[model samples]
Target: MKERTIFQKFIHTLVDILVLLSLAWFIVYSFFSLYRVSGHSMEPALSTGDTVLIDELSYRFIKPKRMDIVLFQRADKSYNMKRIVGLPGETVIIQNGRIYINGELLETTKISPIALPGLAKNPVELGKDEYFLIGDNTDSSEDSRFQNIGNVHFAQIRGRVWFRLLPLRKMKLIV
Candidate 1:
């Protein structure tokens, strides 16, 4: 009798753990997710292999703004992280290796210098609900500056990166 009781208790504990784990997975799947940075395109801000938390709900209430780092849905359905440099109906240009929005030089602040200029080297007018994205590490990033990925629509944005979760030393909310 005691042997049967012990076996039942062990089974119950195992079932409890499984139930908790499944619940946790369901919550994360529906409300949030984690993405690992794949390359150096976001260098100095986000490094390769950095794990970030993506908030899938924020854009539903708020529109993406300039300098917001987002996970963009590419034409091939893959996702890439980049910063918003130009908004809907704004004109973006890369001249003399500096980014200009609407004829004014974009504030570089903490961003790396754009060396190649790429496609945005010529002024591109974004359409309504269109956006221009670029990487913080401009020189090496293949972003809206390229012809193939130019003028991303609002529908292409998957979510905004809200926080860094790994590399414990740098774990914090992304601004």
Candidate 2:
């Protein structure tokens, strides 16, 4: 009788462990995904090969705002990470290595200096569904400033980067 009781307890504990594991799997697969940074575009804030937790569900309830780092599907069928500098229906310009929005100068403290000018040299007006994106490392990123990439459409946005998971020394919530 005692052996049977021990066996039952073991089965009960096994079932509980399985249930907890299943719940964790469902939440991670449904609401979030792991993303790895591929380039230096987001340097200083994020680095190449940094694995991040992408919150894919939040965008469903909220539109992306300025300064938000987003992962987007590029025209070439690749994913690129960049910071949102101009929102929909806004004018963005880059001149003399600086960014201007709606004729107002925006102080850029994150990105590297732009040594070369791109489409932003002229006033680029964003449509209602367009968002201007640029890399924190403007010197190396090919973002909305290029004709091929242009402005990121609302549909192309995949998710917002929320945290870093690898490189324990650098791990933290990405603000």
**All candidates' TM-scores?**
0.83, 0.86
Number of clashing pairs per prediction, in order: 0, 0
Q: Quick one: best lDDT, which candidate?
A: 2
Q: What are the per-residue Cα lDDT tens digits for candidate 1 across 1-175?
A: 9999999999999999999999988977887789999988888889998999898888999999999999989998889999999999999998877889999988867468878877787889999999999988876698998877888999999889889988999999887
Candidate 2: 10-residue stretch with minimal lDDT: 108-117
Question: What is the C-alpha lDDT profile of model 2 across 12-88, one tens digit per residue?
Answer: 99999999999989998899999988888899899988999899999999999888899999988899999999999
lDDT, each prediction = 0.89, 0.90
Write down the worst ten-residue block by lDDT for model 1: 108-117
The local distance difference test score of model 1 is 0.89
